[model samples]
Target: MANQREELDGSLSVDDPILSLRNASVTFDEGNSFVLNDVSLDLGRGEILGIVGESGSGKSMLAEAMLDAIPDPGVLQGEIIYRPDSDTDIDILELNKNELRSMRWEQISMVFQGAMSSFNPTMKVGAHFRETIQAHDADVKAGMSRAREALADVYLDPERVLDSYPHELSGGMQQRALIALSIVLEPDILVMDEPTAALDLLMQRSILLLLEDLKEKYDLTMVFITHDLPLVAALADRMAIMYAFDLVEAGPTDEIIDHAAHPYTRALLNSTPNLDAPLEEMRPIAGQSPAPINVPSGCSYHPRCPLADEQCRSVDPHFHDTGEAHGTACFHWQQARDDIELNYKASVSANPNTPARGDD
Candidate 1:
């Protein structure tokens, strides 16, 4: 089945995406060790693509690689094609420093994780906004007006938030400020790296609502990166699952949630608690994710997967399409699905209070 965005929005198409990552890889100085493996995905115009994974799964690195901001000592390779308009296509990795800087906030912007650390404590919020706008060559007077408008759009009191220092605002306020800052330039696409990870449940909920509002108000194409599966599932039109450094699975949000083909994706689902189901049915994924430097050979997930076999342990598996819009890089996806069904039935039967699994 096609994605929700495709069905509802005639302008968005997967075939000619707004952003396309092709064989994109990020590596540090270590030989043969990658921060992000050859990961490729697409972001359609005005669609939210959720990239979810455990920490150290290269979610942030992938976001950095997308914008040619992979930090010093890290090298990025392959293509990151960006389409500002139907006729214009630019490879982000190939752009010169000046060209890249010109494109960063004006076309593609990011809201980094950890709102507290993102701001300079000594500087007033307005000062940070001024710097961002000034860097992009906007005049000081006009910049402040734009900043005020942006803050107001996020539901913050523009004057109060602009006058206060970063430490003066609560965690939630700081996050909202960050969102305001990222969209101040009115970028076509937004890359958010765990923007709500530090907040409480209430704050997270508010941020999610704000994000939805912003997406529609700005007609923004978004890449939302986080470790929270349910949170992403709630907001995203499509989902991508990353493990160790590779993109293990990606498909429509409902499809991946209902019929996850990869064992790692299933493990994550099992680990997450569902309010409608019995708490006893929830199970944590066994074993820790391997460190990037020492990632396991063959399939990186083979070490922790219950469905692993000799082939899975000895050879890397490429993406195998399981449905029209779904793909998994698992040699035993069919077996994994069968096992997941059996386990799910066993758990629900053991606890009659558990809700039946919903359709994808």
Candidate 2:
């Protein structure tokens, strides 16, 4: 019944969470500015956590941070605590390089965006799978079998896909192959960043269903990262809204779709294309996101928020929770929650699963 977890430290509790990112932030160019600021998230066992945000919202950066995949020149701050099961908890951010490498692909795996482009042009699809499986196994023959089984799981013909190169396959096929490879190990947590970014509407739906089946089949926890809210709501049990490098809102998917509290969340939902609405009725969120180097004082979103006040412009907002895990970073969340919901609901689509509306 508690709203905000006020007393709880940012660590992952072994009881529930498979992975927890606590007060996590990312900065680049030698601490010149933060690309991701003061973000915390929890992915529960067997649950899909959707990270919804815009291009500049650092959703991908947060995903990279989770897997300790941030490249050189970027600095990650704070803790990434992970508990693969009930018996152990480890702070991933503090892990040694070797440990990070070994933990990933074995316990956690990532299905990155641009799978079509991600595969090596020179390597055949089968070769790629064999290499991945062989890296962890001494038995090359057994690894190939596992790879074919994974391909079958994703609805791809194991023989055709393995023999083909990435370029030889269709975009969706290449994507499915990449997905097959990621799940070949059956990692406990699958972190997918925009898995359907390249596919058409039909393929997107196919991938979505494939993901649902994979989660249930493998008993996996999932973190789905994308700029698409409706897509996330379609499969995710819980959702988080990220903006200006901060996690502004976290709640149930339905609540976020129907009763979002943060201004950014409201504006995002309002701006999203309502498939149920004609093109003429659609309206986009006004104002642009401030540059990471030039983030605004106080509430970073105050400039675009219609409900902004003197307090909003000058004093930063902290999250105010509604129940247990649902909360928003907004000074006027209590006052604006109902009005925002009413106004947006009147103008927006109720169904979050409505397929692509094309960005505004």
RMSD to the true structure for each prediction, in A, is 6.9, 4.4
TM accuracy, model 2:
0.90
RMSD (Cα, Å) of model 2: 4.4
- Per-residue CA lDDT of model 1 for 196-285, tens digit only, reads 899876677678777888999888999999998877777888889999887888888877777889999988878877654568888888
Model 2 agreement with the true structure over 1-360: per-residue lDDT tens digits: 011333442221223888877777788878877888867677788888889998888888898888888887889987888887668889887788888887788888999999976799999999988887777763778778888888888888899889988888888888888988987877888889998888887788778778888888888889999887876787888888888887888877777777787878877766667565556555577889988788888888899988999998887776776664567878888677766643333423234453432111
Where model 2 places Cα greater than 4 Å from the true spot, the runs are 1-15, 341-360
Which candidate has the top score in lDDT? 1
State model 1's lDDT: 0.81
Per-prediction TM-score: 0.90, 0.90
